[model samples]
Target: MSEKKFTKIDCKELKLGMRFSAPVFFDDGENMFLGEEKAVKNYHINAIQRWKIDYLLTYGHLVTDGKTAAPDSIYMLEDLEEVEEA
Candidate 1:
């Protein structure tokens, strides 16, 4: 069996089809999701932004192919900063 892994990531990294390993919560500790491996949606992304949630816990694997894989290693903000400095 493939071992499951989780990671905390900036909400900005969230994309449609990414699955959550745990229920996302408000910074105030309110439960925001109660489903297993919930797939991300646009409204969910909007809510994250509207609520100003900076980070969330999600499955480390980007694809759900029943195999272990590393989370996306690229950081969008860091890349943006590098571009700005150029």
Candidate 2:
């Protein structure tokens, strides 16, 4: 299988058809998988804006291996630690 790449995009830039590479979460670490793969939809976009989510990870292509590819960044690790501590 080919490696998938994720790009960090501001929530404001999100649009329909962009597949989420990872589950989105609230500040309290609540998963926002409203649907399969958390596929972006009109309501999802509105909800994201209403929740004030500034950024999200998405990929233009799908992963056939059924594994989500996380973005490559140190900030992600820090975020994970914070979530674990919460």
Candidate 3:
């Protein structure tokens, strides 16, 4: 299997109702944090802050209404492969 790529997102920067297109992973990138289609809620943010987590990683991009969400407060680091293609 090909190695999976990941994007690291800051917990404090996640906007209300933001959703991921794929399952979110923990720092290790193997453990699942939240499933796809699950919108970012108050509780999720609370837990991350309460636990003092710095960020989360995922193989998916942010989505809303089946489209890629535009960057707002979050400055998503570009995937190296994507940058190379551009």
Error of 2 at 63 (Å): 6.5
Best by TM-score: 3
lDDT of 2 by residue, 1-86 (tens): 99545555666776665554365444333344333344456677788888777875444333245544344354358779999999
Full ranking by lDDT? 3, 1, 2
- lDDT for model 3: 0.76
Poorly placed runs, candidate 3 (over 4 Å): 66-86
How does each model score on TM-score? 0.49, 0.41, 0.70
**Relative to the true structure, how large is the alpha-carbon lDDT of every model?**
0.59, 0.55, 0.76
- RMSD in Å for model 3: 12.6
Best by lDDT: 3
Instruction: Candidate 1: give the clashing pairs.
Output: none
Q: Which whole-number lDDT from 0 to 100 does residue 67 have in model 3?
A: 49
lDDT of 1: 0.59
**Worst lDDT 10-window in candidate 2:** 27-36
How are the candidates ranked when ordered by TM-score, highest leading? 3, 1, 2
